[model samples]
Target chain A: MKRSNIAKLIIALLLAFAGYAAFFIAPDEATMHAIQRIFYFHASSGWAAMEGTAIVFFANIAYLRKRTPKWDWLAVSSVEVSLAFWSVVLVTGPIWAHPVWGVWWAWDWRLTLTLVLWILYVCYLILRGLIEDPERRAAASAIFGIFIFVGVPIDYLSIRIWRTQHPQPVLFGGGGMDPRMKAVFFFCSGVLTLLMIILICQRYRLEQLKYEAEELRIAIEERGEPQITQRAKVKV
Target chain B: MDAARAASIILRKEVRAEMRTRELLQTTVTFVVIVVVLFSFAFEPSAAEARRYGPGLLWIALLFAGSLMLNPSFAKEQANDTIYALRMAPVSAFSIYLGKMLANLLFLAITEAILLPVFAVLYNVSLWPVIGRLAIILLLGAFGLAVTGTVFSAVATQARMREMLLPLLVLPILIPLMIAAVEATDELLEASPVLDRTWLMVLVAFDIIYFAAAWMLSDYLLEE
Candidate 1:
């Protein structure tokens, strides 16, 4: 009944429709048939993950400039969400690769960059966990987030200059993709982006709630009411 | 005071302290020597094989040594709360970072200078032909390592599991530098040596970008 719930329901339906479109509406590839279908999900997730990184990059810079909790919250949420999508890309990549390339992994430029990006962000999370103070954590991780994002393009360039065996880009006028396949790919990408934004919103809300709970606990402690403090602690 | 003057003063202090107790340079050189020796034993490569693999091994050893040498850059500043004292000084924060990064670069370069002849003898690789070009690569690579290592050392020193934290935070970001350094070194160490301009450019670009990033972020980085 709520607006957000209604929106969620609509997105859920569209996601299912996207799945159906990817499987059936899109034409089969001439070479790889069913296995090639993974490309739709894999590429879309990669695009969404990249979008998430851009959000995180900007959010980190905003946090650094504004020194606000909301920007930090948005950053952490986007990072976790982007990491989830990247995991999907990494997983689906090898699944598609094993059969096609005769090997599951290659030191290709894109693949190596993806792995490095995942490691860098995972370290970001770990760094956040290590700092106990919330303010320090946000500031420190923002600095780190900006540092690592700056490295991403250089990492890609270095690896690309070293070697490249991954397939060429087909999405942006590079390859002769069927119009139906292109349409399905775009549909899937749009749905996935929507899903990512929704997930980030939900995660941001969770962080807000956690902040509120901490404030309440501190207030109760300041009041020196042990009994209600215990009750409040239990409720939290 | 100008940043360069403040940085020079801090650099003098760091160099003085190290000269009084040669701890980092001595330990790092010994550590890298052991690594080069152990690697030679581990691989026991023929002269031909060593020519192919020696550069990679040498860089890996230097990377480990640099990590070890860099760990105490900020950690030791905590022993007497000297970092806070440095912060309270009238100097800019970037001066502190620049001075410390320069100190680290100096230490790593010294360690590499000592280890090179040892590595050359053990690996049966001649360095006289490519020493000039190789020095350029080593300086650029070492500068990149020192900049990022000093920055991350500051970050890691504030965290739990500080020793384990530095490498995890730094190594991934240093991959491009590592790749470029190793590739350039490999080319120079080849039989018919010719310097590859591309990897050298990559090294230069990496150094400039990270150094500039550190300079820009120095204020935030040194804050409590």
Candidate 2:
């Protein structure tokens, strides 16, 4: 009955429809029939992941300018969400590649950049976990988040040059897509964007709950509650 | 109260301290020598193969040595809370970052100067013809490394597992710089050496972008 739940229900239905459309509505490729379907998922996930990076970039900048916990929470939520989407991209790319390229992986520019982006975000998360103070952690991670986002383009350009100079077999044959396939791809991308928003919202709520719990714990300690257990002192 | 003057003073202090005890330079040079020599044993590359791979290997060694050398950039300031003293000085916070960044760049240059001959001998690559061009690439790459490394060093110094944190935070971000440096170095090591303009441009752009980013963020980075 709630607005968010209604929105979630609509997104779930739309995602299911998109799944069906990708499988049946999209015309079969002249080459690599069923496997070509993976392109829809892979490409959409890549776009969503990039969008997530953009959100985190802005969130990080806003945090730095405002020094607010909400922006930090949004940045972390977007990073985790984007990381999941990026993982999907990483996993699906190889699945499509193993059959199409005749190998599971190649040092192609795009592929290498994807892997590097994954590693960069993973490091961002690791950096966040290492800092204990909330404000310090947020500020430090925001700075790092900005650094990682900026590096992506430079990484792409350098890797593009490196790969071009050492030309590998062209992985994706360039041809005009069928209108139906194009439509399906865009629809899937839209659906994935909605899914990403839903996931980020959920993750943001989780961070909010964490902040509340920490506040409650501190308040309890302030009240001289000797009965409060210290067992939760372990660092995450 | 000039930032440039303050930065120079900090640089002078860093130089004086290092001159008193050559800990970073001595250890880094020794470590890099062992890495370069050990790499030759590991690959046993012929002259042609060494020329093909020597630049890549040399850059890897320098990267590791740079990371090792950079770890103590801010960590040492913590030992006596000298960082707080620096912060209290009547100067912009960016000066502290610039001073440390330049100091790290100087140390990396010295380490590279020592390791270049060792790499040439072990890998059987001739450097006499390409030394000038090679120096240009090394300076650009070293500046990129120092600019980012010094900032991350300040960051990691406040974290747990500080020793392990710097490399994880720095190496992934430095991949583009590494690619440009190694590629440019590879070209210079060729039989008919010509520095490719594209990779050199990439190195220059990378150095400028990171340096500017560090300058803009220096206030936040140095905050306690």
Candidate 3:
């Protein structure tokens, strides 16, 4: 716990430093001026979402192969975190769009795909809720996670081939970023990735605690002996 | 048993059962027709607008029709516990998935064929001139829908609110398929109709990738 607290403290400091760099240090853009500052958070959230989904995909495959609860815990944690990241994307995306694109939302390729992806992952979460059994839930969600992950590439390719009003990916050579801007962007992305890891770890701990409580209840019910304490029963 | 043989056997069983009752097919055809008519009323497109938007409208209707038809692909097996019996069979789980996907594909194809002339008449579009190109596009688009819809239908069959869950799970995943289908259909319906190879290729790729993934994942999906 002490080690985790120290790590958390380090992440918090890094995040504070990244925020300072993005706002006060990075050079102003030629166009879109102050509004473009949202890009730092927006792009980092997008990267976090992408990385989270990738973790879900791999952990899901591992759960299927090993049938381990740890993998299921990891998978669900990643999904929840990923959903939060993409929610940031969806909300911040429009804020970035309205001032620049002159519309609150455009049915452009990238925006539409992201919106669809958000809905698709929401379906994944809802599917998890609808299942009653824990193992069955894990298995089913793993299968669905694989399906959703596979669809992401096709979603991206479809948008890439059929371009619309969504801006091109300027981060990667579309228009090269200034070196200082690149430093800030990478700094923000690194901080967000660290934050995603911390969130998943904390969420995984909650799932672990729940699992332990469930095991304790099962043990108590099976024992059915006279010595069990009332407090233990109530807690269980 | 070989996967192909197992798949063909399941396919034959479904076809025979479906043919005997014609229940799913009849309902789906009627549903598609009603959807097309409802859309015509809802949009009330002019000739010029109809030619531009009719293809998209047709695909939207087909998606709804396909969802209704695919919903019971596995749910009926649950009623008689036949799915358990099928699980005990020697066939691979992928064969079961393939069988259902083929069945759904055929059902959607037949409904689309019926809806096509009706749509042409109602919308006052000339489909006969580009019927060949249109058919290919429909086949690819419907195949993609069947591949994803059948898998998701199985996923939804276990859910409490299944009918609602299937479309919620399917439509978003199928945006690319819908986009490509609508675009290809739009191109085919233009005044000087020409098929867009790029969109057709997208449809084809989507179908291939999803079909392969479904085939690989069906075993996991069908677990008890």
Candidate 4:
């Protein structure tokens, strides 16, 4: 099969499975009732975000060491996609919080830290949008990517040290999670990883197209006005 | 050789400009005093809670007021495209950063210095010992802020709406530092027996880490 077909298949399967699991596979927790089911996707999206962001961070270190555009492109794609999935986790978290916590937000450490992460990524996106030079954009973003990774430790400690609805999974034995909970948690994590890969592929393709378009734009600017339609720019 | 000369020139120019009018300090301190006074309206003028909360409150007000001062601190440079001009002048970007960071640090320090005394009087606490400990914390904490704000000012220098972006970018990371500083201040204020010398030492460590990180990474950020 073509790579496109395989990518599309993976994306579809992950989304379908995630939707199915949300209503069917996952059981409501003993404490939180039906609202607790959101935890599956919430935790999964959060996991995917952390996992994908680690890729971006490592890719940034590679780019800075190598001074390669390709690595920078990869890092940007990974972060943008990670931001999208993390956005899902952030929004759904509040939905879950409203039902359980009896309020939309408290200055609880997990919630506050999550909001901080959300704002940081939003600033990341805003930074990308504001820069016109590719080299400066990559350089600035790499600097920020490295600088801001400090928050990851803070986010981790915020939950373990504070009372929060944010569940800590027993991955490396934080605590022994139940057998059934472990199964659902791992399943959600698996589905989300597949989803992250698909988004990364899509975003990387878009980056390549963007590079081509910039080349075309530079050529046109060097020459004269070309016969390009208004609709074409919109499509781009 | 010549760059050092230019750097000193930049530093002197900033110091002279600040000393001539004391505009930055005057504005920041005045704003902080008002903010503290406003706090009294919000939380009745009681003594006990005020003394308990006063240290954190002063620091919080100073942090916000410092950023308010920071936003315009580089305005003159950005307005005339002087940053580009400065870049052209063969001076190291690090020197330019040091000049700006020092200016901001002084402005924040002045504001913090004034506010601490006023906060003590208002809250009715014997503030000399508290002020001494608090001074060390603010000095270290302000260095982190200055280094961070300087680096981000370069990033924000290129953006259309910097006022909006600077806080979003800086505050998330600054949260950890603020918590540490406030916790340290609280311990000093309450005379907590558990107040370890290690925590103040941690603030000093944070100042060093972020200061070095910002300086080393700034050339990358400032590249054309």
Task: Give the RMSD in angstroms, all C-alphas superposed, for model 4.
Answer: 4.1
lDDT (tens digit, per residue) of candidate 3 on A11-62: 9999999999989889998888888888999989999999998999999999
Report the C-alpha lDDT of model 1 over A35-111, residue by residue, as the tens digit.
99999999999999999999999999999899989999999999999999999999999999999999999999999
Best by TM-score: 1
- Candidate 4 regions exceeding 4 Å error are A18-36, A62-72, A94-108, A154-167, A178-180, A225-236, B2-10, B72-75, B88-91, B191-202
Could you tell me the lDDT of residue B96 within candidate 2?
85
TM-score of 2: 0.95
**lDDT per model, in order?**
0.91, 0.89, 0.88, 0.74
Q: After superposition, how far is residue B83 of candidate 2 from its true place, in Å?
A: 1.5
What's the candidate order when arranged by decreasing lDDT?
Answer: 1, 2, 3, 4
The count of residue-pair clashes in candidate 2 stands at 0
Fraction of true contacts retained by every candidate, in order, equals 0.58, 0.64, 0.57, 0.40
**Highest DockQ against the true fold, candidate:** 2
Give the range where candidate 1 chain A is weakest over 10 consecutive residues by summed lDDT.
Answer: A227-236
DockQ list for all candidates: 0.77, 0.80, 0.69, 0.46
What's the residue-level lDDT of B54 in candidate 3? 93
lDDT of model 3 at position A145: 88
How displaced is residue A120 in candidate 4, in Å? 1.0
